[model samples]
Target: MSKWFCILLIACASAHAAPGAAPADDAVQVLNDKSLLNQIVELQHNVAEKAQSKLSAVGQNVSQTAYQVADSTAELVISSMGFLGLPYRRGGSSVETGFDCSGFVRAMYQETVGMLLPRRARDQAASTQVIDKKELKPGDLVFFNTMRRAFSHVGIYVGDGKFIHSPRSGSEVRVENMRESYWLKRFDGARRVAGTDAAATPPKNY
Candidate 1:
């Protein structure tokens, strides 16, 4: 009944008829043409149904993946938050001993998502994929040049333009605004873990 179906029928009928000859009035021929049209219409309906089903399945998969990523990110951020006020030890990576900047970032990822990151700040930056500041999401890493070098310090971004890190010697792990004057001036860049599902396999060098 669609315009395309009508056009197809006309095209088929024209092809079957001889050039410049009138179509035959044979009853058998009419029945055959009708049968062919019905088959074609049924085939098109089936194809459309299959295509729609496939699209629906793909949409659901995408939504489920996105939800998993968001859930993983929330868990990582919440786990990091629980470590607030822990002392900043120079090379520490545990609750009993405390943690340094990169150590804290590495510990949270390992604990929450089972993903291990590079030990050093610079190495962590090199191992992950680079992303712009505006593209930062919860669980992404934010780098800073705290010690006169790129990526000397790292932290886990907790969204809303804020990050949590273990500041130097006497300070403890705490959240700070990236928009603050000192932080903004020292901001190096942002990097995202390779996988959205928070199950990224570290690179050989990572």
Candidate 2:
């Protein structure tokens, strides 16, 4: 009878030990779940950081572009203003002497922005895009056919429907209105050199 009782106690102890051993497998599974959660969190953080970096780069590019446009426009205005009232000489191209229509434009752009426009006014017109009369803005080159050619003369737009130019041999550099009867009738077209933003907003009538 004592031997039978010892055998029954051993069998009960073995059944309890089996359940305790299963906890080891459960602990390993819990650890694996924690590791997966951590990896997912890390991946999400990296994606967010990359997105923010890209946005900041785009913002900086836009800011730089705007600053460049403003600076270029200001330079154009200043350079054109300096040439005001200079005597007009046919085929001339330097401030030390005088300037013709195209020569004045060439010298101004070269001095201010370091860009070389085509020598002749007609060539300058052909080299640039043909912007509409309504799309005119400061820093644009306004062309004319005063000599009965397609683009024999040129000027620099100074906003407010006006442009600065050396009108003739006896005339000095001056600003004239595009809305006037004579200028409006002789208007040939417009041109833009490098560094001038053609996409800039057009000036409105004040």
Q: What are the RMSDs of all candidates, in order?
A: 27.0, 34.3
Candidate 2 deviant stretches above 4 angstroms = 1-62, 198-201
* Candidate 1 residue runs with Cα over 4 Å from true position: 1-56, 59-66, 197-206
Clashing pairs in 2: none
Give the per-residue lDDT of model 2 (tens digit) for 41-102. Answer: 33224334544554477776665565555555545654565555566788888865678888
Q: How much lDDT does each candidate structure score?
A: 0.68, 0.64
Best by lDDT: 1
- Cα deviation at 17, candidate 1, in Å, is 87
- Residue 113 deviation, candidate 1, in Å? 1.0
* Best model number under TM-score: 2
Predicted structure 2, TM vs. truth: 0.67
Per-candidate TM-scores read: 0.65, 0.67
